[model samples]
Target chain A: MYVRAHTWWTILRIALEERLVYRGDFALGTLMRFLPIITQIFLWWAIFESIGSGSVETAEIANFTFPDMVAYYLLTMVGRAFSSMPGLASGVARQIRDGEIKKFLIQPVDMVGFLMLNRIAHKLAYYSVAILPFALVFYLCRGYFTAGWPDPLTLAAFVSSLILGFLLGFFLETSIGLIGFWFLEVSSLLFVYMLFSFFLSGHMFPLDLLPEPWNLLVDLLPLKYMAYFPAAVFLGKVSQDELMLQLGIQVAWIVFFIFLSRYLWKRGVSRYSGFGG
Target chain B: MSEQQPVLVRVFLTFARNSLVREMTFRTNFFIQCVSAISWTLMNLGFYLIIFHHLNRKPLADGSGWQQNEFFVFLATTWIVFSIVQAFFMPNVQEFSELIRTGNLDFVFLKPIDTQFLISFAKVDWSALANFVMGILLLTVGVWRLTTQSNNPLSLNLANVLLYWFYVACGVTILYSLMISLAATSIWLGRNQSLYDFWFYITNFSRYPMEIYARSWGWSLWGLFTFVIPILIVINVPARILARPLRPEGPWLGLPLSGFAILATLVCLVISRRVFSLALQSYRSASS
Candidate 1:
């Protein structure tokens, strides 16, 4: 317990220091995240107008009305905030292959902790640069504030769901980065992850937008929980019952990926004959 | 000059062959990238389906001629065109900027023939090519859907289609020029990938259904991209050519638009040449 506590703080410290130095490309990445949101917002706006001035009852088709839809997208700006992308994962995996892990293995700091923290640093840098302007534009363009429940319990739900969303993403990305141990190539793995995340997380559209059976299937998938769940929290769209259920799902996924990542790392180390071996 | 031409051709052949062999060695990667590209394209198309499906029961721009199917066709075609530009020129522009950042131009400068051509064409990753092929396939699917709804099938009018193909080629050229200019900024900044990404980010504009984002400020923003950047024109103009004809507003001011696109290409080529020379001036040995 003591060593684990030490490891967590040590990771946070390193992450904080790294976050202080901003890379120009980090700014690029932040701005890049906005492009899809821009397109999505416009796409939705056009559809809403064509829907002939709120003809459909908001409560009937799905949980979201026009204003609710806007908020859902805005919340999605940071929905998977704690997740690491395959780009960074591939870089770490390369280090593992080049046997750079040997130097780190000798260090007292936790290995996976270092990788996750580094990503958190970059994610912080990315969001700080990109999210605010986007949020302002989204709200102003939609001509409304997003609906929210002001209850303390709702806040707690949002906080836990958001943090869990990040953890789930981090563990999944790290576990996949673990593939570098077994395979010479990690790029393919990363590419596959992007595709899965896009479809499963409901990034392209709301989870309910997908037709019925697929919609139910996606909800069962962990991707929907990471991005769609938190966005639903912001919009006050999910039922309290659904919220508890999805949060449970998110926790399960994080546990699954954590174990998967640990197994892969142990197997990888057996091959890591150390630097200059 | 005659003696040097063969050497240039030989170098090009050798570079192309080796890169192909290197890429072929990773067949699994090629499949993954192909699937990934197709999935992202489909995901966006799926979003389009949702919007139009909802709108199908609704009204139009002025609440007239607002068929959901026609708009999807427009989106699919432009996306295919955009994917093509993305696959080909995006790589060249990305590589050029990186070359400046690492001061890696010394090797290219030491080589024979035009350094610009050499630097630009040396690398071709299929991530871009795969996106183009998949995007075109998706666009073709859109066309098939549109055919079921239209009077004149595109298959019957092959000639005009071929003429429009020339403009598509020109559109590709315009895209390449605009990127080369943005990439030229790297010579001064050491790493101007942010600038290239900023331009690529602007491509998000092209994904919207037409006349939807044409609100005054937004439309003109699109117009500025048409002139200064030219990426928007690559998608929108070529798409406009294929889908429709010269408007009574006289090609919707596209004649001057084409002229401006050509002039921008000239300016881009000159600026990149001047910057490339300056970057070479800063080049130092790796030991330093």
Candidate 2:
């Protein structure tokens, strides 16, 4: 068991080193990603300006004041930084299709475990480089967080939700990737997944702005746990009791995806054939 | 020069035909792409619908003259212009960095055709045009509603229609110019993986009405995007011409925006051509 743990540590350390080599690209890319927030600021300001009849300071839409909305968007950016698994799904599918999974079949390394460790390393590397840009952006937009920092308990809840959100994002995407065993081409499926994920995850707009039936439907889905829930927690939008319940639900979803991905992997490996020598 | 024009047209047609054949080879994938594209359009429309509902179906409070139907027209224009760019130029520009890194660009230089023309028209992504069809449907509905429901119904005339299309072409040209210019940077940067992200960020500004960026704090951004980068006018000018044609607003910033749009297109094309040429001149083939 100690030897197995060391091997995993080595895997993570190597992955982190590899990611650090592209630190420059990650830094610039993170900074570029924030450019759209400028547009959002102007857009929401205009919307609230119209709604408030020139008194933009106190106008509320869908229970979000202008500052609150901006703050919500900013916090969602943080949540997304933790949760987004870009290229992971497609990369997995590619490996499975290209017969690269053979290494894992013959080797002692478990593919899902290895991938999870690699992703954790990637997040660590990404955040190390991205923290500066994120801090600069948050500091610049500090005024928007009108309620200021949350209490310690709420802050702890926010942190826990973000970590759980990361796990849920990973397992859910890994399960989608594992579908490669059944379908040779999963790019189109991934495209469909991305389309729904972007909207339902509240990346485009707050799910609260969604009307009845739609909002209720989205609330039931696990997608919100990836983006909207953590941001909501940080903003203190959830009551104390609700936060606990929501956190529990998030854990359940993560567990569900963990099982689903492992099941897919086991079945897929049994059917896997190393066609080309 | 005139003889070369016909040859270039033939080459472009061949490229499009080849792309269609390639797409047909994966009919299921093509169909799924179309479905996904249309789904995205519907979701985007739904987002705006919710916003309009929240606003009580009124014009933007910023005095942008963009009511629900008019904003729909703007959104449709964005889709149309973006679809054309995505279908034709986006794939080619994205591959440009790979060509540079792998030194396959040397073969491109060896071709008898204009290097710029060859590089720009080598591939077409037919799946992206799915948004074009969706855009036209939305545009027709938006126009029909505008004509029927408005206190002053739109006067759709031949001249206005022609002008709208002309400006749409200009919008496509401007975007293509920006894309090719950015792609040219791959020659210097070796592998500009961030090209798409940068392009998306820059164009995100053009997706909304120009009036949204008219606040005191927004003036600098407004000026930069309007005059410096010129992305703001790409969708706004065409959408405004079609959606609010009868309005007597002379021009924005006291300049004739429509005329300026044509001028900007010419400027952009010339500048992109220059940039592409300079990058090619500086390019050291992979062998070197």
Candidate 3:
């Protein structure tokens, strides 16, 4: 167990260094990415004005003000910053397709263990550089957070949810990549998964605002934990007990996905063919 | 060069046909690609549907008196413009870095063809045309709903339809120019991994109505994106002409700006062409 732990630590350290090598490019890219929020901010402003923003009683949309909506969108960006594993799945699929999986077979590495450790390293490296841009942008738009900061407990829950969200994302994506073992290509499947996740994960809007059946159905899914629930927790939407319950649910889903990925990897390796010898 | 126009046309058709054939080899993959594009468009449609449902057709102040259907028209125009670019230029521009890395550009230079034209048109993503179909469908439905649902619908005339298509063409040209110039930068950068990221940043500004950005806070964005990049005029002009004509606030600017957009598109194309040539000149082959 100690040897195993040491091996994974080495992998994480190397991955972290590799990511830091492109620190400038990563930071610039992260900053450029927030540009889309400008359109969202404007669109919500128009919506709120059109619906009448005179007062809480007079406004047509009662639940969400323009500032609230903007804050939600910006906070969702933070959630995505934690949860999005940009090219992990596709990278895995490509490696499998090109017979590059042979390296793991020849070496003393476990696929999922190596991938999870590498992703942890990647996240650490990302947050190191990315926090600057995110902080700068969020500071500029600080006025949107009309509700102000959350209570201490809620803040802690929000941070915990983000960390778990990253784990869930990595496992879910790597499981999807494991499909490449049976299929010649997985890009199409990955595309479908991405499209569904983009909507159902509440990246587009608050899931509560979605229609009845959809809201209920999306609540049952694990995706919202990655985006909506964390932001909602910070907004004080979820109660203290509910926050604990949701975090438990989030951990349960992560465990289930991790096991699923391991099961798939085991089954895949039994029939694997490395063509290049 | 004038005498070679027919040959160029023939070569383009051939390239497109070969690309289709190659893509068809992976039948399921091709089908999945189309389905994927359509699904995202549908999701966007659903998202706006819900937002508009919340609005209940009230006119937005910053939306320039736009209601549900008028905004749908704008959204449809965005998809159409984006799909045209995706079909024609996206795949080629995406592969520019790969061409440079693998030294395949040597073969491109040796061909008896205009390097820019050949590189841009050599690959056609036929599945991306699915979004074009979806866009047209949405636009037709939005226009129909606007005429029927609104109390004072904009006049739908032959002039508007023709002008709408003209502006769409101009919009596409401007977008294509922007993409080609960005792709050219890969020669200097060796590999621009964030090309898609930057592309989204630039294009996101054009997705909404220009009116939203005419405010005090958005004036800089308006000036920067409208006159400098000229992306705002791309979708806004066509959607405006067709969806809700001139709305009195900027009637003179509306008609005159479409003309300027055409001039802008031409200027952008010329500039991007020059940039591509300059980049090509500076490119050292892999042997170096």
Candidate 4:
């Protein structure tokens, strides 16, 4: 068991090294991804200036002050950085379609385990390189963080939510990829999934700002855990009791997704046909 | 040039036919792709509906902000322009690097045709037309609501409507220039897979009202995007022509900006053409 654990450790180490090979490009990409925040900031400023009576204190749209709105946007970016899986689903689907996945079946490796470790390595590398950009951007927007840092307990909850968000994102994407067992082409499905996630995950705007029926319905979905909940926790928008309850719900969703993915993989493997073999 | 125009038309028609045939080979895939595009359009519409609902009571300080119907018109214009780019140019530009990688571009060069024209119109993404249709539908609804519901109904003259479409054409041209130039960089960079990511970043600027970027600090951004990239005028000018033909902010601003947008389109096309030529000169065939 110790030896097996060590083998996985080596795999993770190698994957981390591989990611570092493209560190420069990755870092630049991360910074470039934040460019949209320029427009967001401008748009919000305009909105508040128009709606509110000159000062931010007067502009309370859906209980979000201008500073709170700005803070929420920045925090959501952090949450998204943790949870957004860029190419995992399409990469897995391509591997499955091309029959490269058969190598995992024959080798002494589980595909999902291997992928998960690689993804963990990727995150480790990403966060290490991405921290500088996040720092710089946040520093530029420090004035917006009027409420300052959360307390230790809330901070801890925020961190936990981010980590869980990552796991949930991974499993969700993996399950989508596993659908490649039945369908050779999953790109369209993946595109549709991405669209839903972009809107539903609160990446566009705060979920609370959305009107009724939508606000209530989107809350039930797991996507809010990826972006909205973590930021909400950080801003003290969610109370301790609600945070705990939401965290519990998040864990439930993650566990449910994991089991569903495992079941799909098992069923898929039985039907999976290696093209040449 | 006039005689060759019909030949160009024939070539484009043939290309469109071949593309359609290729797409039709997998009918289920084509249907799925269409559904996927439509779903994204619906989600975006829904999202904007929520936002506009929140801002229902609050107009801009100078009445420059797009209200529910006006903003929907802007959104529809965005979709139309984006759809045209995706359908006519994006798929081709995306494949340019692959063509270089696989050495298929050598054959493209050998053909008796304008390589840029051929490369730009090679593949037609028919599924993207789903969003184009959706955009028109939304535009009609938005315009109807704008005329009927708003206290101050905007005038929509035939000349302005014609100019709106002309500006939309200009927008498409500018996007094509930008994309082709970006794709040409693949010759030097060798497999630049982040083209789409970079494209999204730049185009996201055009998604909202140009007036938002006219604030104090936004002046520099306005200059950069207007003169440097010219993406600011792409969707905004056309949308404004339809939704509010008479600019409440400044009357003279729209005419001069529209003229500049047309000039900018021409300048972008020439610059992109030059860039593509230079990049092609630097290209080493894959076999070599």
Candidate 5:
């Protein structure tokens, strides 16, 4: 137990140091992240205003009018802050591929602690600098910040769901990156993974807007937890019961991917040629 | 004249041929990448379709009198121009900044040709050839669906279309210039990757329909285009070629487009040569 606690402390220290080294990058990335959310919000607002006459009211797809879309996509921004884990996946892969992780293996550090700390550090910096301001501006503009907060139990469930959501996301991406060991190139594989994420993860637009079976089919995947369901929770759309159900599902998927990643990493390292020479 | 042009042609063709041969060893990988590129276009097309269906008979984002299909076609054409740049011009210059950092640039300088041309044309991604072909096919479909807005396909007539190709060629040159200039970072302080990231994300500015706006904002982007980032010219010039007024009160827009394309190309070539020489001077060779 003492050894594990020491490992965790070491990882946290390194992660904190990493953030300091790339302070400018984090700041710039945070600013850029706002652009997409703002662009999507304004563009969607214009689209709905023009098409809906004032707002879409067909009772189709959750009665999402022009204004509701603004609110919905804002939720998208906040959830994205919580669930997006691109750095952890790519960072770990590069470390392994470059054999930089050898330094850690020779030390007394825990692998999970290091990975989680790296993720936590980036998110802490990014969320504080960028996403929080974005969430505030969006809330003040739309009046959803206070009005949209569900009851305490519901809000608590929402936050709990997001933790599981992030875990599943990290697992999914890291497992794919782990393939870099056996495969000569994981760049193309990562691109393919991004393609799926863009569509299925509700990154661009929600899956519900698509055809019938697709909306239903997407729920079977953990992607809905990544962007869509979390957004729904933030909007006060889901009930406590549904939130609990989805949270359970997210946890199950996370465990499955974690196990899969461990298996792949072990099998892969056995084949690693230490191509450094 | 024939001797000069033939040598250039032989160089480009040989580069293309050898890259194709090298890529064939991993043909399955190449095929998936091509399909991946195609799928990207399809996803964008899908989003536009969803919007188009929602916006039937509606005015545009700015309360302008533009039809959805008109803006859609404009966006589609811009995307096609984007694909051409990504496929034809980007690979060489895109690799440049990273190459400089790793000292892999020595191999490029050792090549027996104009270092500018060779470095700007190296690393021909064979998969991108299919991407180019696929883009034109998507553009054709986009134009055909554009039948909703125009009973006459006269806008796509061959003579006018050839002029548009000239504009696209101009756009490619400017893209190379901008990329190579950014790549010249190896000369100053070796700051390529971060610079490339800035360039990569800036391409988002062009992904939208230009007809919806006058591209006056983008014209100022020209300052950034010629000097800071070349992708601005690559995206905007092509749109300028195809940007039709919603009402068509103007006599001709295509002429100005041809002129701009030529101007941008000349600027690209000149700037590129200067940048290359500076990079060469800065080179502390591997032996050093």
Candidate 6:
């Protein structure tokens, strides 16, 4: 067990090193990503201005004042940063299609465990470089956090939700990629997944803003845990009573996806033929 | 050189035909792409629908003169412009760095035809035209709604329609100019992976009505995009002509908004052409 843990640690260190080598461009790219927030500020400001008759401070649209809306968007960006697995699904699909899965099958290395560690390393490296830009943007928009920082207990809930969101995103995407075992190409499927994820995960807008039946339907899904839920928690939108309930639901979804991915991997490997090599 | 114009047209036609053939070879992929594009449009439409629903079907929150139907027309115009860029120029510009890195650009220079023209029209993703069709449908619906509404001042005459299309062309030209100029930087940067991200960010400002940016704190962004980048006019001028024609009294410096759009398009084109040539001169080929 000790040797195995040491091996995984070595894998993580190498992955982290590989990511840090590209840290220069990573910082610039991450800063560039924040440019859209300027547009968002202008847009929401206009919306609130019209609604409040030039008094944007008091305007509330869908329970969000102007500052709350801005803060929500900023917090959602943080949540998305945790959950976005840019090319993980497609990359895994490619490996399966190219028969690279044989490497894991032949070796004693567990594919899911190995990939999860690599992803953790990737997150560590990404956040290390990205933290500066995040801090800068957050500082510039600090006025929007009108309620200021959450209480310590709420902060703990927010932090835990983000970590669970990360795991849920990873497992959910891996399960989709595991479909490559049956279907040689999953690009089209991945495209569909991306489209749904972008909308359903509340990256585009808060799910609470969704109307009637749609909001209710979206509430039943686990996608909110990835983005909307954490942002809502930070903004004190979620009630104290519901916070524990929501976090519990997130854990349940993560467990469900973890099992689903492991099941697919086992089934896929059992039927797998080591062709060409 | 005067006769070369006809040959260039022929070459463009050939490139378009070859691209269609290539697209047809992947029938399922093309179908899926069309579905994906349509799905995205629907989702965006749904988002706006919810927003309008919240406002009780009022004009955009800032009173930007964008009622639901009028905004739909603007949205349609955006989709039309975007589809043209996506179908014709986006794929080519995205692959510009790849061509540079792989040394294929050297062969592009060896050709007798205009290098910029050749590179820009090399491939057409026909599936992206699905958005074009969707845009036309939405445009028809929006126009129909506008004409039928009582007390609406919308004028759906032939002159307005013609002017709308002409400005739509100008909008497409401005966007194409911006894209090509950004792609040209790959010659210096070696690999401009952020080209798409930057393009997405810049063009995002053009997606909404220009009035949104005219307010406090937004004035600087409004100035930057309108005068310096000129992207703000791309969709705004065209959509305004069709959706809500600006009153003649509001002309900027004796020129109508559409007139300014035409001038901006010309300036953008000239600037991008100069930048492309300048970048090409600095290109160190793969062998070097």
- lDDT winner among the candidates? 2
Residue A217 of model 2 has an lDDT of: 92
A65-89, model 5: which lDDT tens digit per residue?
A: 5555666666666677788876566
Collision pairs in model 2: none
What lDDT tens digits, residue by residue, belong to model 1 across residues B1-288? 677888777776777677668778998776666677677777767766665565554532323233554455456566566666665466677777766656566677787568777876675665656766665665566556655645543342675466456656766665565566566667666677467557757666655434455554556656666655555555555555454422222434357765665566566557657765665566553422
| Model 1 lDDT on a 0 to 1 scale | 0.64
**DockQ values of all predictions:** 0.42, 0.71, 0.62, 0.57, 0.33, 0.69
TM-score of each: 0.80, 0.95, 0.92, 0.93, 0.78, 0.97
Off by more than 4 A, model 3: A53-62, A91-109, A269-276, B1-4, B60-63, B245-253
How much lDDT does candidate 6 score? 0.88
Q: Evaluate residue A34 in candidate 6 and report its C-alpha lDDT on the 0 to 100 scale.
A: 89
* Strongest candidate by TM-score: 6
- Model 1 agreement with the true structure over A1-277: per-residue lDDT tens digits: 9988877777776776677576555554654666666555555555565564533233223546666676676666567664436466777688878877776688876688787777776676656755655555664656544343546777788888878887888888787777888785787768767777776786656787776678778866788866777777766677888878777878998999899989888888777565485
Candidates ranked, most accurate by lDDT first: 2, 6, 4, 3, 5, 1
Best model number under DockQ: 2
Candidate 1: deviation at residue A133, Å?
Answer: 5.6
Could you tell me the TM-score of candidate 5?
0.78
Better of 1 and 6 by DockQ: 6
Query: lDDT for model 2, on a 0 to 1 scale?
Result: 0.90
* lDDT of each residue in A198-234, candidate 3, tens digit only: 9999888988788778888897899998788888888
The complex in candidate 1 yields a DockQ of: 0.42
The lDDT values for all models are 0.64, 0.90, 0.85, 0.87, 0.65, 0.88
Clashing pairs in 5: none
User: Model 1, residue B136: displacement in angstroms?
Assistant: 4.4
State how far residue A124 of model 3 sits from its true place (Å).
0.9
Candidate ranking under TM-score, highest first, comes to 6, 2, 4, 3, 1, 5
- Those runs of model 6 whose alpha carbons end farther than 4 Å from true positions after fitting are B245-254
In Å, residue B114's CA in model 6 sits off its true spot by 1.3
Positional deviation of residue A64's Cα in model 6 after best superposition, in angstroms? 0.8
Query: Looking at model 3 chain B, which ten-residue stretch has the lowest summed lDDT?
Result: B245-254
Which residue pairs clash within candidate 6?
A: none
Model 5 segments beyond 4 Å from truth? A37-42, A52-77, A87-114, A121-158, A174-191, A239-245, A255-277, B1-3, B57-76, B102-112, B147-156, B211-287
